[model samples]
Target: MDSKYCPDCGHPSSIKRIDRKYIIHEIEHVLHFERGILYTIRELILNPGENIRKYLSENRSRLVKPIIFIIVTSLIYTILTHLFHIEDGYVKYHEVNDGTVSTVSKIVKWIQEHYGYANIMMGIFIALWLQLFFRKFNYNFYEVLIMLCFVMGMGMLIFSVFVILQAIMHFNVMSFAGAFGIFYCVWAIGQFYFKSKVSSYIKGFFAYILGMVTFWIFPVIIGIVIDVVSK
Candidate 1:
């Protein structure tokens, strides 16, 4: 009879070899708070391009998966915003206008309340857009999504810190952070996908703009469809 192989450690396994120690170690490696998660977050923030390139080229076993990183950072962002009582300008605008928020405003508020999910949706849209815009690169949708997950996760982490500071300092810094995020996205794409800085910058600029427009327009289009269907 052939021996079964352990999928994780890639060694021959038997029922007798499965023990408490092995189970505990596996759980700790996969779910412990401090292992690869912190390292990946720091690398993503300090040296995103190189970090992403290394993950793409080298073994990814040591790093937290990009999707999990994005989700964790996004949850932290959401929690921080609530904890700090960070006021969104959109909400403030609607609050000041006749004390009656419109349907569009309501939609925007729902989107903001679920910002993490919205971000994932936007990431999908941007990935598709990039696949089309950079078709010559010949990268698949999943690869682009992996890159975007890292980029967006890093952006969210930076944005969350700025939000905390803005709350404490009583100054608006989100615009600055938003601008930096856009620039960082451009630089990351340039570093990973394009050989020429000039070409990458040009494409990244247009791609970012288009991404923003699509994100904003998508909700409006959906709202319109909903209204039409109800009527």
Candidate 2:
């Protein structure tokens, strides 16, 4: 029996794991807001860079896993938008042919529907630009990707806040939400590298904006090429 458990953490082997107590405990923990999703959001909202740095260097257990955090947050935002019936520029792509949906339009629609998974894909794309701009810092590409998962996860929450406000106020505030979302992302990434110099922040802005532009523009270009080739 002892051999069936992990030597380090005493976790049971796959064959011995018939119980779902762990699953129930996790759900209870989240429902109670005890050092889980809510805690991660709070730390991220207040001091994302410092806290993420701490999570990377000091104690990983304090936060939800980066990828999981992003997925959960993205889902929350997705649900909020759906509940409010909100429309934003992020999903409004123009189709070239009338009565026909272009590949790019389909992609946009998919992204909107599955923002949780799509966020991870978008994070990977944005990480490339961050790697180029922040190469001097010596952080590897995957590290930037991890940082983005947390930062952009918070970005989703930030957008969710604006959505709630709009719903309550009965007015349009999505424009401000998008602008502030970008600003928060740039600031978080900048502060993550170093907060002393303005150069880090400036570079962060270019890194993020370029990454976003390249992500969207690349898809549009490919869709255009494919459309032309088919015609």
Candidate 3:
């Protein structure tokens, strides 16, 4: 009779069947209350570039998956914003039309309401500029995207902390949080490329701002095209 374990390997005889249960079990076991996200957070805080580099090159068992990390962190920020009524307009805009919802307006409102997914979109936008600025580096566009996933998630976490602080202290701190988030992102991007360089860090700063501007410009361009097509 054939054994369950591999005859030569002494592991599962065949590949273990992967189903929804397998996925759930992995998430539950790895991302348990004691570790997982918390450990990821700590590592990212300490050395985001080094940790992310390890994630790509070395074992991935340590940190949470980038996609999952961003989703979870964005959810935390979104929940806190709603819970504390923090209407700082992180991704929102005031009415621009005469009670008519334009394409850009709708998109902005959707992003405001769904930060978890919106952050992913925003990350892609940021990744474009990052790849452009850091083209000399070995990292490709998708690699850059993965890096932004972790970086932006950290930014959301930063925002989440400030939102909680604003709620408790009754002092507006979202702006400060925004500054810190941007600073961290720039530093992480710079570190990812240059071990130590003033120019790389400076470029990192511009890359982030340009990435944000580029993302914002997309909705406006779409809105214009829609209006032109309808007219």
Which number leads on lDDT? 3
Model 3 clash pairs are none
Model 3 regions more than 4 Å off: 1-35
Q: What overall lDDT, based on C-alpha atoms, would model 1 receive against the true structure?
A: 0.73
> lDDT scores for all predictions?
0.73, 0.81, 0.83
Model 3 residue-pair collision total: 0
Give candidate 2 misplaced runs (Cα > 4 Å).
1-34, 89-91, 229-231
Q: Write the per-residue lDDT of candidate 2 for residues 33-107, one digit (tens) a residue.
A: 465767888888788889989987899888888887788888888889889988673345665678887877766
Greater lDDT among 1 and 3 belongs to 3
lDDT tens digits, residue span 25-45, model 1 = 876665435467777777766
lDDT of 3 at 87: 78
